[model samples]
Target: MSNTQKINSTITHASINKCAIPYIRYKLVKKPPEKYIKSLQLDLFSQFVTNDKSEVSNTVEIWESIPKYFLTPAQVKKLRTDTGHADPYEWNYSEKGGNFTVRIQPALIKQGNNKYQAFFPGITEELVEEALKKILTIQNHGIHDVNKVETWVRFSLRMVLKELASRGRDRNINQIKHAIEVMSSCVITLSKEKKEIWKGSILQDLVTVGREEYLADTDAQHIGRLPLFISHAINQLEYRQFNYDRLMSCDEQLTRLIYKKLINRYRHANLINNYHFMYSDLKSTGLLQQNREIDNRKKVLSALNELKEKNIIANYETDERKESRAITDVKYIIYPSNEFISEQKAANKRNSDSDKHSIDPNLISVNKS
Candidate 1:
């Protein structure tokens, strides 16, 4: 059967919104070009293809590949706008069918003689996300030498700022700076096992060596050192690659968080076409918060609609079952977008090929008997 026919059959029984689904009609390449095949063969055999850490690639770098737990659900929370300081909070939960418990605890970091207290003073999704994003850039590009005991990465501050506050022209420079400061200042312990075997901060040190010039277009370079634990974690976990452009285009923070959570949740289950999210599931992500349940529900729906309009997902089908004149146990069918599927497929293919080659370095020859 053709790809189009398979997709049609999948959607037919699902009862999805026809209008919002983008055209997924892609013609199959029956005979790939000789050059393309040769490149594929090279990719299959070559140990090295491209480095993410090189200066050239870092300029336009977007997609960040890091440990899933860093940005996954329950990592971040909604903060009140007027709050002066972020009160320390603890998160302990299990994900992916309760495979293992994930825990986050706010703690202090010791550097040399001085000790710094880590707090989320004005922590926002974008802020913590920026720090992770930059670190992900470093990890993805092989810019930092992992073999070294301490893997420190330095990157363009202005470039990151531009990407973080891409929604606005002026850029939220102050906000980004503060978030990085708070995140870098303190240490957070992440443990997965019941015995608390592993623990460390995502970042060890964040320093600005160059003085900031107010009028300068490009600010001084900023350096960040990742803890060995965090570096190892990034290398260990499987990462999902999505369209960074599409993700950033949606200005709403909540929507972006939802998108990421969905991506992380379904990173491995590609065959699972539909994801049914409950009301509590949505609220847990810190995407929606209000005094009343009704208000919060409205916000969740609004955010989902925004994602739908932006084509972040193919479409969302709402299942609002009324109980006591109030919507309870609201469920949603989140259809994966074609664009997202294609990107993930390509990323998985590349990763699988890389893993295959990495498995047996001596078996390089492809014998055609």
Candidate 2:
């Protein structure tokens, strides 16, 4: 499989609509001229790859012997297949089952109280500062009472924004601006009841981040853990509550796979199963007929079965008002959870907020004065 990368800055992405790079990166891993590299035999050269972390090669002794292990791309391919490995066992970046475009970034350093700084060229320093302020305020309260923690609160803010950029948000200015603010600012606050910041999906309106699947720390099949230099802020969502460190672990990798599979069928199984789908009600109200998808009773039944298997609702009976009015006419049904209303309310809340606080599109007009 040959691969190429497309790096974009809003304009290029607009002109080239298919610019969003998917999983998998291709590297030109080249071999050096024979006698010279062999003669030097430095410690950084790779030998055997364990879990694909190349950092382990530093332990090898016998300096001249190291160069022999610097295998060619063809040699690496043969060795990988010989060992029953499908990949070259190297640390690489990729999107879900898609090719990767190698992205490079400079490191960051913590500054004075409640501040952070990074050396990346593409983004503005002002943007970084504003994002850090918002995010730090939110997380600071989580880890320590904001009033007590005197200094910048010992957390890595840079990592969060970088997570967004790495997931491909940095490709567009509109998205970058939206994400930096969304990840940093307090769009929704905790409503004392669930300690849940039960606000609607804040970034839904903006083409800010990638799809929901990208919010998770995906597998090597997508991209490996983002570079450590970036902070948790990048991948953290205001409405979602997932642990960051654990998201990169092997267990999370498996969970991400399960989540993707399950979500692909989200509308069918989990959601429909829970709805007390009054076929008669949906039909009379025109939700079924107007929807065109659940036009007949069959899709509704299929959705109900999936819901039942997923345990989204409990079993019950449906009394068919106009059926042949028999005792056995009742069928089991599922009722949507109270949380469903919350999600809807949250969605509405998001709509209102967007109306109130959205950025002016004219400001973003490109290639013109």
Candidate 3:
């Protein structure tokens, strides 16, 4: 069948608002907002309902291929102590492999800034960021327009709390607010081979306006914005979709990170069932911070067990290398669950269907002929 026929068949099987098709086509090519808004009004005035819920529990890839350690999984108190008396909580980390070097410097705030004190984004901040990304994907805004620094979203603390709740994280309004502050305040400078790639906070220009009591309410709404770079990445389609439900199911920070790493690797490998990684290499991902080898080994084992219990992975085997009767290194062979593989396959098919259907609104008539 023709691409158009295939798309139409799929759309017919799944009831999609016909009026929204024009908007979707326009959005696929990154049309101007005013133009798309006009199209929406003219094309989808009556019987128009956005199917935003279809995006729930899916994430749009935002973070680049930087080391996972960019955002430490360490506890907040330990992170604070490790940074010492340095104002703005600055620290430098470097990793070298083969011919390239990655250098990262993360600070709570830009140098010489005394207004806001932020720390390295821990699990809480990471969760908050993921929630925001989910919101961005659902709303389908900000990402298409990279030139506008003012591209922002207005959402309620209640809305954020609800998203967090879906991930099995029960955080209060105060904690959510703090996570936003940290994300907005923290500045990260990442470079490869001495060439700066990224330099800014995860979020910027956050403006929240609501009374404490009102904001505390479940229905209260507020606003936050993403950085321009993030928007650009989303515009470039440099994102990944993951099952948020499974990610949040892993209770420990390392487990969640490991799950993410595995998913990325598996996807890259075309959904292969088996994959292996050196234990020391995994430790370097910043997911493992325990000082002693035994402690780190225990943490890794526990995380793997949690993944198994959650059915994210079918099973895993570890190989320990010993030098002079002392453990020198470890390796892991991971087997992904059948369910996880099926989920990924379904997601890929959905994306493929969407792509097949995405013809420019202007060209739809010609293509139909």
In order, what lDDT does every prediction score?
A: 0.44, 0.26, 0.53
lDDT by residue for model 2 (150-269), tens: 112112323445643543323344344433333222122112112221121111111122535343422211111111011111111111111121222212122222222222222233
Q: After superposition, how far is residue 315 of candidate 2 from its true place, in Å?
A: 7.7
In candidate 2, position 362 carries an lDDT of: 25
**Predictions: Cα RMSD each:** 14.7, 23.7, 11.1
lDDT (10s digit) by residue, model 3, range 1-369: 000100111121012212111211111112224332212111211111123333334433324333423445344445454433233333333333521233332334432445433356667877787677666544433223333322354566777888888767878887887677667665655443443434555665555555565545756544455644344333332234566667877788778777777765676333455888777776656666667889999998999999999888898898999999999899988888887776666556544543443354531221211
Following a full C-alpha superposition, what root-mean-square deviation does model 2 have from the true structure? 23.7
Candidate 1 residue-wise lDDT, 19-41, digit = tens: 12233343322221213111222
Q: TM-scores of the models, in the given order?
A: 0.60, 0.23, 0.69
Please give the TM-score that candidate 3 achieves against the real structure: 0.69
Task: Pick out the ten consecutive residues of candidate 2 with the lowest summed lDDT.
Answer: 59-68
Best-matching candidate per lDDT = 3
Give the distance in Å from residue 332's predicted Cα in candidate 1 to where it truly belongs.
Answer: 1.1
Clash-forming residue pairs, model 1: 52-141, 53-141, 118-186
Better of 1 and 2 by TM-score: 1
Per-residue lDDT, model 3, residue 291, is 75
Question: What TM-score does candidate 1 reach?
Answer: 0.60
Q: Give the Cα-based TM-score of candidate 2 against the true structure.
A: 0.23
